[model samples]
Target: MESGMFEDEFQNDGSFLHDEFEDGENFEDTENETSDATDDPKRQGWLVQIRNLNGEVTERRMWAKQVPKLPVTEQIIVPFKGNQPVGTDIDGLLGQYLGRLASNHKLLPISFKKWPEVVKTYKDWVWEKHIKWEPIHEAAARTSFMMDMGKKWRENRIRLFHTKFDQTLSREENIRNPPLSIPPTEWAAFIDYRLEEDTTKKSKQNAANRAKLTINHTGGSKKLKRRSEEIMSQIGKPVSRGTLYIETHKRRDGSYINEEARQVCEKIAEIESQGTVPVEVAIDDSLGQVKGAEHYGRVRAI
Candidate 1:
């Protein structure tokens, strides 16, 4: 049931990473980044807020050393501070591991509804392999591991479609370079699906929708949520989304990364000057000029 539903989502939305040919700048670029925070969490210190007995509030410094850590293959990670993992991508660290687990377990056509099953399989496999993990830190269930797996599954499928499997090439030629995790049988079916007329049309439509995006992030794979939290820790107050957006899109030289960013930041500044306008409202006003979408303000799901 879930597989069929999610299969429709794929057909209607294509890879959801980007346009058919590349991991579009929309999501694949925003969400796919490697974390280099594997060193001593002490270096990051703890970005924390302290409330005193006098009802006064002050920010403080801390680290992953203060919180629990998850053993994710090679690096130790603190999983989204016990919240829904969004905006950030751990594909660099966990993508291949997820791919292998799903392939080995015959858990192809991954779906959100089946994430619990996948997590169960992961736990069982970890136990069998005797991989040590804190009982509380279940990477499969707690972090964005499953989501990254889903993205990797779709991204690699499209990559294979574009790069290795040539339309002019014979079936044997195309299937010869099947992805490491994909079986030959699955590869042949994938090729057939991509060649189907309905599939081609849907992919084109989805790509068109993605291309309509007016804003592109320059935050580069850094998780803005964590970065915002760090800023709050330093400034001792909440950072508005508008401020964060403008800050992230600017270069060290105080120049906007692109014209669109400059325009959006300008619009935000205008909105702020008028009175108090929500960040999303400011973004909608700016984005609506180019892209006709209404209320499409949430960029970073983090």
Candidate 2:
């Protein structure tokens, strides 16, 4: 009887009751297989929670039976214009937030430094835009005096007691016995003095040399002799021999043999007779002896 009952239970179905039993067993096996799949060790579960300003709680949970791996530096929350909270350091809040996110995900932080130069540049720009040009006291005084005189001339009337007019009166008073105190002239002299103060030593030397040359070349007949004496005095000391030769011959005139040229020529002939050209003649071909008619043509008529 027990064998007969086991045969009935394992029989290949020809009855509705047998078929129902087989289908139910298969469904149970499928449910067990799905439960085993959910028990995988690599699967993950995560939860996120947030509390609103009004104390409302929100929660979210997720299960991953076969989730893929994420990148090492993934960001959890992206900032949006309407949702981002204000930070204490507003100037670098975005950078700080990015750095924090990078740190949480094991990434490098972006570099940041104080830009003091930007503030300084903006300040300089503002100053240049609005600042007025202020003249010095002397310049202001001169400008005001000139402006007042211009106004008076425009009105076609003279003010006897204007400050500038009074200053002029005082100048006349000093000019009689004491020194004159003309402010305009004094201002001009002051400007000249300032200019002179800025002149270099080389410039002063050149001016003195020019004055000496000028005086040497003046006064007609005796000018050549004076120029020759001046040249000799300057040679090897104040002036080079080449410079002296050039300056002496610069104005040959072709009318008369000047004493300066005669002296230079005699010196050149003596040096050449000694079998050596003078240092001056060697430096410049023009300073060498003029040949043929050109030489005698320059000699003065006896």
Candidate 3:
């Protein structure tokens, strides 16, 4: 009798009772299986998130149709934005171009300390965009892409600044004098005075050395000691070099005071003329005597 009852319960081609015990179990398993299939990363599409300047975050679910197919391996080529292609030698013209952008683009410092961070940030952005770039090609791709982006950004920013703010971009001619009360023209003289002071110290030491050598220690000569005192008295007196410097300063308004120093000043002036001056600002946003950025902008009209 028990065998017959077990056979009836297990029959495959017969009627079955539908209740929570059986139906609920099957339904739960099927729902979980569907959830797992949908959650499978391989089968899922991409999602993109963008945060705007106003701090609003927007998300987009990208479907397959929305994405472009990856090009075949053989079809891949170095991306050329202008005449130059990605991964090409950048040590020449491209480097110079980036350097100019660094100089002219106020937003881009293009400094040794900051460039690596910029590159890394760009790489992360590309990754977020689902651009599957290889590790070997990442640097070239990032550099080329950044160059194109920076060039455009700088140009657009300049245009915007001019159009909206009624201000042109700052140039080398705008370089201000050093914040010291002394004029830049007088710096050459000041530096001369300091340099003469330096030479006098050396002269003092030389005088001491000479006095020691000339002293007749065995005879204990009083005249020789007086001579030593006379030599020491001349220690602070300007040397021939200082006199020559003074003459040159008078000749050309100190333009020829220190040839090397003058050359450096000229080189600095040249760079400033091109608006490539390296400026330092306190984190408090002071630019020399300019109190704040707003005041600085008013002064610079940048």
Candidate 4:
């Protein structure tokens, strides 16, 4: 029966259900009370005032967890010293108050007693280790004076120092006196120098012109013949006399005729001297005469 009773107790889920119910209620209560609970600390009356030995009321705040305990008489003395008031039996009350002030003002929390020694050590170290090497106003002035003196010495040395070759006595003895009023002989020498230059320039120009003539007469002739052959080949037939003349004259070296061309040209010249009308004009004149022979004869010089 006890075993059965234990099994029944294990199966019972009421306690678990009750816990869940309680948790839901507690969550609701927490949600409703959260804002009030959060504001309670800030709204607390932490700041207070107490009378000092001088009968002046001094204000203090009890915000921090660790309150400074001091004797009432000593606390009174602190207010006289312009320190924060504290409760009796507080140790380091003044320091703690000063620490809060320093924290609030973003100042380093330095003990008044140690400040003088720290400053003294800092000044001594700076002077001995670093300041001595630094250029101060007085040192800079002295250095500038030395520099000026060095510059002046260098200038003087440059002006004074001279080798035997540079000595004025040697130079004066060797000086060629400025040509005693530039004699007429010197004018003749100047003319000779200018003549020599002009002769050299003229010779150079003549040599260049000769070289250009040789290139044009020799190399240019071959190039011109090749170009004329190309033009004739492109025309694909014997060119008319007038057309051939124009094309040959346009070439660089075609001004001079080959032997064959010279013979042909002589024959043409002989034919031209015969006083015959050219075929072009003869044909046109024949046609005109047929149309009106009397009018054509009057127009013609014949």
For TM-score, the strongest prediction is 1
Cα TM-score per model: 0.52, 0.17, 0.20, 0.13
lDDT of 3 by residue, 188-267 (tens): 33233323566459647866887865212111111222222232355653122112212223222444434554443344
Per-residue lDDT over 1-302 for candidate 2, one digit per residue giving the tens place of the 0 to 100 score: 00001011122211100001111111101011122122355533333222333334343322221111222121111111221211111112222222222221011111111112123433233222211112222234224323332332222211111222234344344233321322344334322332344433544776787887521421222223233445556553333333344454434453214666566555644544454443332333323443213244352110
**lDDT at residue 268 of model 2 (Cα atoms):** 47
Question: By summed lDDT, which 10 consecutive residues of candidate 1 come out lowest?
Answer: 1-10
- Residue-level lDDT of model 1, residues 14-49, one tens digit each, is 011100111221121212222333235444433333
Q: Which 10 residues in a row give candidate 4 its minimum summed lDDT?
A: 13-22
Superior by lDDT: candidate 1 or candidate 4: 1
Model 3 stretches astray by more than 4 angstroms? 1-123, 126-132, 166-302
RMSD of candidate 3 to true structure, Å:
35.1
What TM-score would you give candidate 1 relative to the actual structure?
A: 0.52
The count of residue-pair clashes in candidate 2 stands at: 0
